[model samples]
Target chain A: MPKLKRTDPDERATDFVESLDRGLRLLQVFGTISGPATLSDLARAADLPRATARRILFTLAHGGFVATDGKLFALTPHVLTLSGSYLRSNQVVTVLQPVLDRIATAAQEISSLALLDGDDVVFVARSSPTRMFSAGLDIGYRLPSFCTSVGRAMLGRLDDAELAARLKAMRREAVTPQTVTDPKKLLAAIIADRAKGYSLVDREAEPHFRSISVPVRRYDGTIVAAINMGAHVDRVPKQELIERFLPLLRDGADDVKNRLL
Target chain B: MPKLKRTDPDERATDFVESLDRGLRLLQVFGTISGPATLSDLARAADLPRATARRILFTLAHGGFVATDGKLFALTPHVLTLSGSYLRSNQVVTVLQPVLDRIATAAQEISSLALLDGDDVVFVARSSPTRMFSAGLDIGYRLPSFCTSVGRAMLGRLDDAELAARLKAMRREAVTPQTVTDPKKLLAAIIADRAKGYSLVDREAEPHFRSISVPVRRYDGTIVAAINMGAHVDRVPKQELIERFLPLLRDGADDVKNRLL
Candidate 1:
């Protein structure tokens, strides 16, 4: 679980602040752990020296971003403000959240919008009719793109050469038994989705979960993101998903495109 | 507006990482400014030297946390991951979101949960029936505690002496024409809400927006947060809010208590 993308800046860069990078990395490390972590645990998880980790943690604590109880440290709610700035200022999230909410209510399923970040798709806005299937799918949740409906839907918008490069660069893994790990097959699937105007992934990203997605295009018809509706396989058959939700998702995407700049 | 509270740690602390603190402050400054910002604008907003701001921006940019055009910088979606770790690990948000969604759907208004962070209440979870009135009340939105129903409800659970001290320390201002700024009146209102088991704020924090909230207690009877439903004053009168929404909020709060640790 190396969360930092390979695109991370070179440490040798003169202006790169290693301490700030390490501190941010440490914050993400806390997310990987279940609960409060000790100094040793945080240091090991962050792959930093214990003394360095302690200094970073102390700084975080002083800023009210981290909470401590004797030997254990945990993040405080103040950390939410870090993302609040991006989310509030993001036009994609601000404009499309209502569309997703409407789609979720009308379709009685979880609705989400994801943007391609690095080789992964990050959920930027989401709405749910119920709490079901919220795990790992909330706003800010990230997933490998090649194996997810939203990922493929967004990838389908890329030029063939760029898509091929991305697919080759992706570290394809069998997230579930149904996941497509072959590059050629995945590319074909994405191409077909591009032609069909949507992408559907069945039990590929998660067990028993299937999703259908369509790319949301900006005014110039450039794809900006992907919007999707996901459900448990037990509740939604493949045919029902295609026949019922695709039109709704497309309409929602259209609405978003009209509203978004 | 000084977003950092007065409780900010003494910068003279031995382990204080000034660069890290300045980087985090810069991130918040971007949020305050709309869209992309010039380096000078960001430096001015963050009150940092141009050279220092440039270095931090380069580090953030290298980390993919900040995006820069030829002349301007904006936060990238990667910033969301900073909060993602906290939100995903947070029990309060994980446990209360579904409950809030249920309340919102049932009540046909927006429902939210807020926790006291310093003298402000930070919205930790929220659900909306429609996207109406969501401008400044989304999850992670922070508001002064004295004038908000959710804030008052959470403060009501504080011991009288602590509450008095908090009110005395508060930088109360007339946020709206109807906002009660006097410490004594705010304290009395909080006390009355505690006695009645709910807090109602009418056009105090925002014009034409009224909300009713109930304190959520932990298994040990310690107040953990507050849950509320808010609607436009035009849509729901003060009498109807108390008569219809108070019990629903209380029940939601009770459900949260039963489920939370």
Candidate 2:
């Protein structure tokens, strides 16, 4: 099993330089669980003592990045400026969104853009109709890279040595019955994805859901991210996913690369 | 004139504490000005010396928030995770996006959620159809509070003293012929917005565009933000804006409030 590393609050708090890391950890705590948290809840969530959590919350509130209503502390709209800055600076989102919108409208399925982050894929942009799914996957959801189409597409871009290292460190526990747990089979699947120029994941991360993904390349021809079109297995047959969705996904990726380049 | 602060790069460079601010400024420089920038381009945009810009850019590149190709630097999708944290932490965005989407779909116009920042309004979220006129508004875009329907709606939420203080510090300038440049008239508009529960502006920020806006309240009854629907003047007449768009904007605000609460 891969060793699980807990965010060490004590180690983070020991040095003044690490306080930034501590502050980021406090921010990260908000995403690890669902719902808003009170000061006490934040302290427990961040694994910091109550007094330390109070100071960090106070400072964040003073900076207008977080809001407190005399009880619970939640993020403020100003916090979006941090991420909005990222989206704005990176023109790929602006370039990709219209393409994703077109794909979503044409295919009538959920379309998403994701990037590799340590053994996980973080969703950066998505376009979907309201009735398709009640649990709306917004801009921040992170999922394990081993089980999702976007993950496989991104991993397929990496060289064998790096890919092997990543596979060696992956946690192989099944998220669903169809999840690829065997290392050798997963490696083969990744190799197949590279040859095919796209990846198709079926009921791996969640049962009854199918996703097809293609890599988004930069002007230099390096794979920086991947795009995916996802839907229920009943709504989209595997053959239909490849035939109908794959072309649109590839076209969208090409458009993004063209506009960005 | 309101004091224009120069972002002090020298003070920022020596202090490790200011690294966050420096890093954030580097990200801000990338917003819409250019796709990829050389070190000198970043220095000019960030108003820093080449050396300072190089250091910050190098650190960001090392952190995977940016990618450099020897000559030019560009932001990567990994930066989205920072804003993603903020979006997930604030439950309001989840509640608000659907309402904004509905308004955009209904009106076939640009709809946005904005929050007050000092004497300005900063857009946090926006939804728009392909034919919609954006008026150059994007998330994190800031504009004066006196000249926009969304700005007036948010300003209406402030008490008299707070409102006066904000107005007193602002430098009123003509954006377009219809812009409200008079302080007294702007104050009256704000008061009227409070009484009517909405604000409307015609050709104020730009020619041939009109907008209607309403405040989004939290469960505690505080106006946390405002939402706006914008259309070309030819599509939405003054009366039509108040009659048709107002209810949609208000309904969207109410829906957002219900979900958030």
Candidate 3:
């Protein structure tokens, strides 16, 4: 994964609290590994010295966010409070959850809400029907902004200069045979989505998966996020998505805008 | 809320990262407040010096875990990665989510799985049917063990001495009119649940909520978590819960135990 971009030069200055940043980075490293990690494993993955990693681990364990069985360290359920704090305090999820749940039930597919964080679209809220795709696209799942339906929908709201800049900064790749990798073509697709009020992608994010997304606007008429519903290509034909799910998604986005403060 | 217990004397020694602990505690304080907070608000709530809190907030902002509009600071969607990391790494939620979803759909109610964390049970996975109660019982919701059905189900698995100690340590309060506050009665109820292999609570956690829970065990027969289904009291009678939900919850628990490694 790419590192978080440091926009400010004073990140290394005295006011930054370097150990706090290292400790949080270590927490993110746990997600990249499969199971419990030893001190050496964490130090190697986080690119920190063993002594610094050990101190951070000690602090995390003392905070009840990480647990240890003497030899290996793993995150505890207490870590959920950090996410819970964000979900509960943020108004976007609170406003969009029920709206997306209604859309998911009506569409009989997985519905999700995502926001553009840096260059990736990070899913923040989701509502799933009984039947779902095997992609495991739960909350916090992230995908690059140049290819996903939700990403295109959200990027459509950006100004021309910013859109071109993000598109240039992205490590554009053909993740699937159908993914559009050319910068000019990607820009044209996003521009078309801006005119159409929605975006549709076919087999770009995952094979046999098709999704349509609509941008969610706030009370001030500014786009805050994007909402999408998706299904398998065999299950949902491309034409049917534009006919059935597009209106439903647009309605859901409108409801969210009206409800959001 | 009470602070995390520090059992190791070495917490005050050189190896501990005090700023990291303070920064995490500040994150928790955000959950206790309403929306965006000023530096003074966070410093007061976290009980840290203004300068200390300011530096930590800067570090968190640099890490993309927080956002600021110059005057007020709020958590960004990036914070969800912390909880997402825990969920993705923890095997228990991976095994229980599908089982709980099936149970919830079949029962037409809300089903959840929670693990024992200190004196509280933190909800880690949940599935809700089309209709749900007004309470926001999403993942990461926390309730005291002495009153909630899932809490009692898991607490019943603890050794006698430890269970008694936790019960005594709790700040025992009557959250609702129907809550059981007496320590002896709470212990008796939990012990009965142990014998019966399930726990049922009527209007204890909330005024009109009732739930039935079954403990989820691992391959070694040690309880790791608990699963439950709940409904409004008027919608589900006590006898109906035992006859209908109890069997379903037990089957779900058995399925989780079998699947978990």
TM-score each candidate. Answer: 0.86, 0.80, 0.91
- The digit string of per-residue lDDT tens for model 2 on A1-261 reads 111121222222222333344455676687665555777888898888786666566555555666666566666556656666666655556677777778877886668888776688987777764332212225656789989999999998778878877887898778888898887788889999988999999999998998999999877677778999987888778999899999999998887675545
**Any residue pairs clashing in model 1, and if so which?**
none
Please name the candidate that would achieve the greatest lDDT relative to the true structure.
3
Looking at model 3, the pairs that clash are none
| Candidates 1 and 3 compared by TM-score, better number | 3
B105-129 in candidate 2: lDDT tens per residue? 7876667878777667887777765
Tens digits of lDDT, candidate 3, B116-215: 8888999888776664221222677889888999999999887888888879888889999999989888988999899999999999999999999999
Superior by DockQ: candidate 1 or candidate 2: 1
The 0-to-1 C-alpha lDDT of every candidate, in the order given, reads 0.81, 0.71, 0.83
Residue A18's lDDT within candidate 3 is: 92
Model 1 over residues B1-261: C-alpha lDDT tens digits? 011232224334777788888988898888788767778999999999998898888888888888765366777878878877887767777888787777777787778888888789998777766543332226688899999999999998778888888898989989999999988888888988899999999999999999999998877677778999877988999998888888788887788676665
DockQ of each: 0.32, 0.20, 0.41
Q: Which pairs of residues collide in candidate 2?
A: A83-B83
Q: Is the docking of candidate 1 incorrect, acceptable, medium or high quality?
A: acceptable
Residue B224, candidate 1: how far off, in angstroms? Answer: 2.4
